[model samples]
Target: MFQFHVAPSGDDSWPGSAERPFATLDRARAAAREAGGDAVVHLKGGVHTLARPLELTGADSGITFQAYGYGTPEQEEPVISGGRVITGWQERDGVWVAEVGELDSRQLYVDGRRAERAALPGLPGEVRVTATGYVTGGGEPLGWRSPADVEFVFRGVYPWTEARCGVAGVSGDGDETVITMAQPAFGWAGELYNSTWEGQSSSGPGLPTRIENDAAFLAEPGTFVLDRSRPGRHVLMYLPRPGEHPSRTRVVAPVLERLVSVAGARDVSFRGLVFAEATWLRPSAAEGFLHYHGTGYYEGGGVETAVIGEGASVTYPAASVTIPACVTFDATENVAIEGCRFTRLGASGLGVTGGAGLAVRRCAFDTLSGAGVEVSGSRATSIEDNRVHHVGLEFSGAPGISVSGTRDCVVAHNEVAHVPHCGIVVGSGQGARILRNLVADTMEVLADGGGVYLSGPQGDSPDNQALVQGNVIKDTHTPYNFGLYTDYGASWVTVEGNVVLRADNTAVLVVGPPLENVVYRGNFWDQDPLGHDNPPSGVTYGGNVTYKDERELNAATAGIQSEAGPRR
Candidate 1:
């Protein structure tokens, strides 16, 4: 059993002993490779920032990264980051300005609280300028010293669409801040009915309620402005929380795309490491979102439903440093990641593909823009006893933990809540055991979604092959959001022994066609378990229990939250 040590202030030339640790993860992994067979690397408690991804291979097998001198079993381990901490702030003209590098980031953190990008003061006026932004209802004399640093963030433009674009230039046409989009809006929005590339004025008054990331919107504390007009770069922040100035306040931004990644390896593990502050490109044509059009339903008797719209929906353009995964595995086998944290990430936390006995247990995934932990085409994978929340921050379509096109995978004993979309899903393929999990506060902002959604099958597995059992799903307060949904020709699925409480729609929705022999039994719901638009065949639902009082059922799963995380 060989052991390598890594510290924040250590040197790469050091022997990786406890007294003289290695500086980078690469050095420790090299030492582990030299030692071979069941070696462990202990990371000292602090931030270990990565300039590039720590790419691992089959040689990286039988290695582990564990945190040392930090955290109890109940506390978080040391942080390994793809982010650079920003310091050296000066009060310039009432705003705190610090020079960051020439890097692009949509997410920013101030004193541990997520800061909103600068925004417009409020709603805009009736008139808009060509492809530029709207003439605001109150666009007085605004000073946009750096238009390149300014971005127009349009929230809730439609059900699933949110728009953000940098300003090419700002023209004050009389009382209007004519915000010209650097990338034309029509090119981004596409040719909708009459909606031009220049955002067509909605038939109604307007769609956007919050337009953010401009200088005028930086009135409140915890709001920030990034100015890229100067020689290097500058981030202007408005600090609101008490006892926080430049010296006292700490800011961080993503520097690398991925902190840790492994591919084509076997028998490795990542233990007790905090993966944080990784960046992702905001969804673009380069990294486009697929419009599936309910494409999971299969029509052919021979061809099965593909796992489209299943895992990470954004097809990020191919680049090592662009598509960041906090910790990723591909085509590996017999690996484990235990008691780790996946937080403040711009993209998916853990992405495992085509691996067997891959265990991601007792981990926490928080404040992520993409899916929490997504596994695809992996056999006998185990994702158990983890806590996931506040994920899908930028994209609302991805699930918290997406088990797609995998056989005999176990997604059990996890607590997933406060996510924008599905909590746990078996998108395609089969033989999954979804058991003893707690799902709540989900499906927050999408047009149509559920807490636990099952789509059509890949030709390999039948509907009854997966088991949905012993989960507590509740408090999904969005329109068309259910506790459970078997959508788009989901066939022969078994749903049993789950507690479904307080969903916006029916507790279970089995919609569309080709549905056959779906059995539902011993499940508890506060409302009607089935959707109003029920499918046309082969559903045997009996032995189900309904309750008008949801508190009783909530009491049944009472110890779930405390078991998963500290009280928020």
Candidate 2:
């Protein structure tokens, strides 16, 4: 079953059916390498422009690039696109040439004879250079000669008029003047304004332009690397809207940073796409969405995603997903990311650390700028049936699912909501199985927090065996909140038949030390008359049902028993 059709008016043979088709995707990948092995090249939707970056070499059982309808089929389905309109410019000898415009600009020759130039008074054409006083001969008049022993380069003016201007110099001594700008001029019509070194430096009119020196300018567009030290400067003339076309929202962040380094290439796939309104800067910890390093098996099917801004939607621009405090995993196993939709990412949306066995099913991680699913050092993982909602907005340390140092993990039947903190957190794990999950409006505030938060560390022995059973925690705002929180090195834990309701505070909270074996059976605590927080030992409340106000249970003793339900 092989059918190819890629417009621009088809015809490059190899049974080029669909009424004689085959425009380009490298002549349908050279007729799928002369029909020698794995196949399926059907991309017939819209836009396709790739002059470079298309490497899907030989195959040995690794290929599947699909996108042909099923769920999320709006914005004009069947679309595979690529763009390039960086036009003409040349000044080979002496660095300052232009011809890459989707929002282009060029002009560089900041040489004030052995550089050291200063003029700081509301920057009227700006100048601040010093990095061992620049000296690169030949009729020098490019300003900057010692304002603290110099090395400076600041040549500006490319807010796109289809950019084309010239001048170049960098004859050694802390050299730097590499400006290859056109990722739509810092994307979405560049307007990340506000820098005089950020905050309370009044000089407003359209405030958003800064350039400090030690000579180092590198804003590599396509391969992605938005910021690299030595006072790197950028503020390409703001244009939110006014006949907008800053290279089609800055070319959707260099085409999602070149589709995350070819998304683990090997029979690669990027189908029917439209990466709109972009801006993904500095995402590395081996980045996400699709990252598999060799040993064949890199497949990405039917991706129709959108990342507004904040480092192109994931991997901590502000924090939606950031895993890379140093990653190490060799024998990378069959990685898979199905049906994608990771919107408004930031502050831990889906971060799995140092992968071993990762799986994020039926993906739909919510409007985040932080926390909705963060698993650390993954090993034998399975975050099943996901439908995680609008998590903590960068405040109460957001949690809707946070597991640490993973091993044999299983956070089953998920459906968590507007979390502020702790909706299901098993920190520093071992044998974890937080079964049948359905936690609601979990722990917002009241100092430390819980809706099923089990902690570890403080004499070890905690990560042995954990099981917070049959979950269904209800509306909790916080008042020393607890629906099931066990601290102090939890060992062999179990909180059965869960259904804790509208608790203002405390339903079952056992803190630090004394847990050799803990169990609270047949649960149904609908307390809110302010109760709970002190049961460090002997916790085995059977056939549970403490309706409310039994004189606030008068600080239960005598093996605590009150059984009686049906009063709100």
Best candidate, TM-score: 1
Q: What is candidate 2's lDDT per residue for 1-568, written digit by digit as tens?
A: 3445455557666455656667676776666656652555655555454544344433411433334343345422332322232223332332223333232111111110011112221222322322212233322223422112111111111110011111122332233322222222122112221123222321111211322221122222111112211232321212122332333333221222121112222333333333211112232111111111000011222222223233332111111223221011222333444444443332344455544555556555554434566677567777766666665432234577777767767787677776655677777667777776767777653234577777662122445567777676667674556666665456566677666666565454444444546666666565621213344454555565565644443333112222111011
Write model 1 residue lDDT over 416-484, tens digit each, in one string: 998876787777777788887888888776656777888786333463377878777778767767788
In model 2, what is the error at residue 480, expressed in angstroms? Answer: 13
What is each predicted model's overall lDDT from 0 to 1?
A: 0.67, 0.41
Model 2 global lDDT (CA atoms, 0 to 1): 0.41
Model 2 regions more than 4 Å off: 1-253, 256-568
Candidate 1: RMSD to truth: 6.3
What TM-score should be assigned to candidate 1?
0.83
- Provide TM-scores for the models: 0.83, 0.25
Which candidate has the highest lDDT of all?
A: 1
